[model samples]
Target chain A: MNITDLDTPTLAADLDVLERNIDGMAQHCQQLGIPLRVHTKTHKVPEIAKLQIDAGSQGITCQKLGEAEVMVDADVDDILIPYNIVGKPKLKRLTALVQRARITVALDSEETAIGISQQAIADGCVVPVIVELDTGSGRCGVQSPQAAQRLAQQIMKMQGIDFQGIMTYPSNVRAKPFIEETLNLLSSDGIPVNIISGGGTGSEAASKEIGCTETRSGSYVYEGMTRVGNSEMLTPERCVLRVIVTVVSTPTPERIIIDGGMKTFTSYPPTPYGHIIEHPDAKIYGMSVEHGHVDVSECSHRFKVGEQLSVIPLHQGMTSNLHDKLVGIRGDQVETTWQIAGRGKVF
Target chain B: MNITDLDTPTLAADLDVLERNIDGMAQHCQQLGIPLRVHTKTHKVPEIAKLQIDAGSQGITCQKLGEAEVMVDADVDDILIPYNIVGKPKLKRLTALVQRARITVALDSEETAIGISQQAIADGCVVPVIVELDTGSGRCGVQSPQAAQRLAQQIMKMQGIDFQGIMTYPSNVRAKPFIEETLNLLSSDGIPVNIISGGGTGSEAASKEIGCTETRSGSYVYEGMTRVGNSEMLTPERCVLRVIVTVVSTPTPERIIIDGGMKTFTSYPPTPYGHIIEHPDAKIYGMSVEHGHVDVSECSHRFKVGEQLSVIPLHQGMTSNLHDKLVGIRGDQVETTWQIAGRGKVF
Candidate 1:
């Protein structure tokens, strides 16, 4: 299929750019002597995961059990789920995952660990469990190292569970100090930390400076306008997701409406709807399900109704999940289409 | 499949409540003696559209050509596109749609009218075009009466198009005044107005006061959090769409993590990630792609890992597009499951 033949308001991945992004990030980690565990939550396609693995990634990291299921289905041997897995259905799934490959999950509470242990015992498999420490996102994970040690101690006492290491996704600029404090507290109690994992696309450099065994970054593989707005290293072409929006209504001298809105392009960090690829002066002011409000008041040429514009989303990770398939384009030419195999893998 | 058996995270609708909502809206419009043109953009399912049509909606309104295609595929007869259609490919699709049903499209520009005229001429069909007048959403449509008259004049002169009537969405308190002014302007030019369309769920009472011939509202069939938040009459059970999320992690004494994120619920209008159904005290602090941040600090009971929470999203229209299927529930019983056939129909 040609690029133009793709369904309007769809996600298009530049395979060549995606490969460069994967190889570049993997090479950076290799040069730094740190392992790279790329997160699969961004592009849930199995083919993309294969490319990342081929680029020398130590393994793939999944934030959810469903994502891990996809990575495992893709035949990626090593999988690390940096999320606390709970619920009988998910635990049963996780324990079953252990039979096929190396399976490790994050634990932030004793209650969570007990459930994992029971599921592991029932499945007749011992699973490695890591402790998720809340460095700064302040959203999840255990708060203090004391809490970590307490949780880890509880997990160590479990029969079918192995306490592996400590993990934390530190908030921006606090990686070094937070890691040091947590390390001192855990090691002081004589608890060994084997797989200290932390970091994302934004904090990758700071994460490496903290001396963690591995770093996890997802969006770096498909840099977006939001990431590029913050980081200077990302190139626009490296962005794997693009929304092809058609101009629906040009109401005034200043505004043009596009068919792609919040449904097609997700509004995260609440940034402008999207970055207009061809028109630099056009800015997305607001959006609804089927209409995008573009303020092109400053642009010289007017975008007539029915015109299609490719937009790089402010956030790429969540946008791809909005669709079912991704058209893999290699420089204005579509190579093939990949089903977002694990789309809506929120569980 | 039973709604409970669907294995989804948040299934909140009571079948009884949904029926009441649908009936209530239809009855309200029936009592007022105004033709109801329910917008199908919210519930893109053809079954719901059929129900609305069966219950006495004058016709159905679609926001995108893709959605109209789905509705036409389901054999829906009368369809109104409440958006400006432009471009050759889109115009061709609109022209092709003429063979299936009676298609009435909104027009706001002479350029677009000319384009559609050419396509309709080539297709050997006379297209019914409604001039969309900007009442106040400030989003689309012609602002002044003069601009609407000029566009209507062009439509009358076009080879394969007929200026049927005028349309406007209620964005301000003066919608009636704007519609009246546009009608007066067109009549001054000796143009006949047949279908004067306006109104939504929010502006139904106001719409009747404005006295348009038809009113289009989609959210009334399936109430959402946004409508519930603003409406004095609706309840959570009346809401037809919800994101079923599982507690992935309980990070702190205060916060509980759920597996539904922006992908499951669109964060338009920037409300807290989601509203907990039974737990009103819980505020969704933040969200990642597949995880939700629930602030449970004020709650007495700790949310055990793996527990399911039903989160009511702010916008129901966009949330309906996030999933492929919807299961209608009556208490704990699954009544029916409908495919969101219009999911991602953003072309």
Candidate 2:
């Protein structure tokens, strides 16, 4: 099948670029002596997870248990969920999941720790937990190194839960002091720090510099923006996935409408919705629920109603969740189709 | 099952409020002497479409052929696709779809008309087409009243195509003069204009006042905001659909983290991500991919981990596309679960 011959508003990923990104990140991590835990939240496809592991990723990280369940069903081993698992319903599911694979979770509060510890003990399974520290990003974590050490101490005393190292998101310089102080406190008490996980799109080198044993990187698989020792940058050529949309209506000389909209693209990165591969001069000025308003007044190209344009969505992770399957294309030919099975698994 | 017992970050619609909204819109349209064609984009559930049809809707409107196919497979009868159908792949699907049920498509260009007409002719099907006028929306439409007549004349000359009347989104005061002038011009050419369809969430009364025979409304089933002769208004009690989420972490006294975030909710109305029912004084200040940053600085009540809250998304239609099922609830008990079967059908 040819790429251009498919239906409009279709999600097509460049297989060449995908391989390049996978190989690039795996090599970068291997050289830095830090294991890369490919975060499955970006592509949400188990096939991509296999590719990352084949490229030497140590393991995979999931944002929720629902996604981890999908991966476990696919025979992928070693999963890490970096969010607090709260409530009885999730606890029951967590107990069932730990029986199937190597499961690890994160915690920032004693209440979260108690819930998981009780569930793990009752299910006759041991669960590994990492203390989450705030560093600087004030989303979900303990405030200071002392607070993290306290949480780690409580987790260590639990019978069924093993206290791993620590993890924080978007590894930055602020995490350096906090992680170093907490590591000193834990080691002095004779506690093992097996895993120190940290990562983001442009913060891989920082994750290694801040003393992380593993980095959970998700966006690097598709959008291809990495700042690990200048390994990769945010370039159009680095982006693997492209949304193929056709020109549906030309309301005026200054405006044209594509079939993809807020449902296909996203409002993340706020301005300049997408990067049009065919017409870089064309500005995607606005978007409705089902319409992509494009500004082509400055472009010399005269777009027809049936002509197709490829758009690389600014935020590929959010956009991947909107579609069911992704078409893998190699040079104008369709190679494979991967179902985004982990989408909408927010449970 | 009780609503509180369900998993965290579940999409639930209040059955009583859903019925109140459905009945209110049906009664309002009954008094106005206009047929109501429910737009299925808001809910994208076949059961909700059936409810709207049972409540005196003439038919339903789908934004894309993919959604129209889902409705057709579920035995939905009349569907109006108020967008142009271009490209051969979509044209083939549209031909097969028109064979199953009554499918009406809208067109604003001669190229789009020729493409659909050719495919319909090859498949031996008569496709109903409506002339899309601008009406100040600046999205997808013919520029002026004269341009509408010219497109209608061209469409009338095409084979395997029936020229239905006209349809415009967001029926406003600006649509009055354009629709009236086009009606005169189209009628003088001895062309019968049978359907004058115009609609939006808060523009149904304007649709009737501007001489529309039927209005397409979809948000009334869930969000419950309408302006059909003051039939309803935007209020907390009016919103039928509520996204039930749980507080996973309280990082600070002033801040709490909900499990729902950009992937669960959306960045659509741009400010105040969601209206928290439990914490009325609380503000949803920010959103990450899997965490909703909530500001409870002004709230008198204290929040705890594992506590649940109800949130009505500002843009329910966009948020509806993010989930797979809509749980129907009556007070505290779960009534039914409807698959969002028509979601992500943006073909």
Candidate 3:
């Protein structure tokens, strides 16, 4: 099927570009001697996860049990959830996930581990636990290396828990001291760290430099390199996904309203919400609830009603969370339509 | 059936608040002697549209054919798609929609009208068309009152098209001149204007004052009055829906990470993404891709891991678009769970 035949305000993934992105990330991680564990949060498609694994990724990482459940159903093995599995409901799902596949979780607090440990004991499964360090990210994880050491020690004593290693987001220089201190502390206690997993799209080498055994990169699978503050490696064409939208109304000589809006593309990374592939000069200055207001005043290109624009959204992860399907297209011809299976799997 | 039993980071709509909001909007429009055409884009639930209709809404407004189709399937009789139904795919769906329900559309250009008229002719149906006026929105609409008159005249001459009236968003005092001038221009040509549709959540009085025969409101059904900059009519408890999230990690004394993040809520209306209800003094300072980073230093209440929080998202519509289900609850008991059938229906 042709992409033009599909409905407007749809997601179109350039298959060739997608393949390149997946291969490039895998190769980059491999060259660094760190196995690539692709983060499936960006695309959330089971097929794409399999594609990353096929491209030589060691495993896949999911933030939610619901996402992991979808990946497991599709036979995409070796899933790790880098999140504190808190509450009884998530613990129940986490324990169930351990029975199906090799499920590992990341946590900062002993309360989170205890909840999982109890649920794992009841479900009769050993869930691998990773101590998440703050590393100056200040989002989630223990504030200090001593706190990380304490959580790891507690997890080791728990019956249905296996202490994996340490994990932090966007593995950077700030994480160096904490990770090294935690390693020394754990080694002195005779505890082996199997995985010092660090995450980032353009920071895989940094993760390796910081003594990471494996690196988890998500955005790299779909032109996420630029988003991670590394512009030299990323080109516009490398952006695998483009939101296909049509000019629904050329209201004025200066303004053109597209079929897509905040519902289609997210509002983050602020305005110039999307990069219009057809008209490079057009600026998406504002957005209504359901209409993308494009300022075409500066552009020499003439926009007309019914004309289509392939827009590469500023923030792909936020955009991916809004859509249900991702179309794999080679030029105008569509090869496959995959449901964003992990969409709305926030729970 | 208790909300505490339900999974964290899920949408919870207070049934009592939702019903009150429904009744409140219906009463406000009725007191002003203008019919209410509720916009279902905020909730995207068939049942809520039905509830609005039951509470004296004349019809419902959908932004897309997909949303209109969902409402039509749920037996929502009158649906006004306040968008230019451009291209073949949408026009085909639009024509099919006219057969199932009383469908009306708003457009600012002849090209958009021609496409709809052609499809309507082939389908042997009369599709209602409303000439959208700019009225200073600078989004999608004809530039001036004169452009609106031209489009109305063109619609009157088109085959299988019914010229409904003029339409503008966020109806205010500024729309008065454009609406009145357009009404006079159309009257001079002996063309009767039936429905002068104005839209906004808090401006029903303004809509009526601007010669609007009817008004369309979407956000009011979900505590959207405050979002429209009218805080007098809205209360904190009146916010019908709240995103239920759990504190996954209280990483520091100041920072706590909630299970829900951008995927669960939205990034718009800027900082303090969500109004933390449980701890009023607490603030949602930042967000990771999948975790809400909250600053709780100012709060007297001490947060713990596994603690639940009911957060009122700043912009309800953006948050509503990302979810698949809208779980209705009365106090703590689960009342109903409705699929956001019109979600991802931007096409």
- What TM-score would chain A of each candidate receive against the reference chain A? 0.91, 0.95, 0.96
TM-score of 1: 0.90
Per residue, candidate 2 scores C-alpha lDDT tens digits across A161-212 of 8888899997997789999999998888888999999978667788989999
Better of 2 and 3 by TM-score: 3
Assess each prediction's global lDDT (C-alpha) against the native: 0.78, 0.88, 0.86
User: Taking the tens digit of each residue's C-alpha lDDT, what string does model 1 give over A249-284?
Assistant: 778889998877777777665546677778867888
Superior by DockQ: candidate 1 or candidate 2: 2
Candidate 1: CAPRI quality band: medium
Model 3 error, position A345 (Å): 0.4
C-alpha TM-score for every candidate: 0.90, 0.96, 0.97
Off by over 4 Å in 2: A224-235, B224-235
> Candidate 2 on B65-181: residue-level lDDT in tens?
999999999999899999999999999999999999999999999999999999999999989999999999899999998999999999999999999899898898778999999
In TM-score terms, candidate 2 sits at: 0.96
Among the numbered candidates, top lDDT falls to 2
For model 2, what is the alpha-carbon lDDT of residue A80?
A: 93
- Model 3, range B197-220, lDDT digits (tens) per residue? 999788799998998988999888
Best candidate, TM-score-wise? Answer: 3
Q: Give residue B189's error in model 1 in angstroms.
A: 5.6
Predicted candidate 3 versus true structure: per-residue lDDT over A113-137, tens digit per residue: 8898888889898898898888887
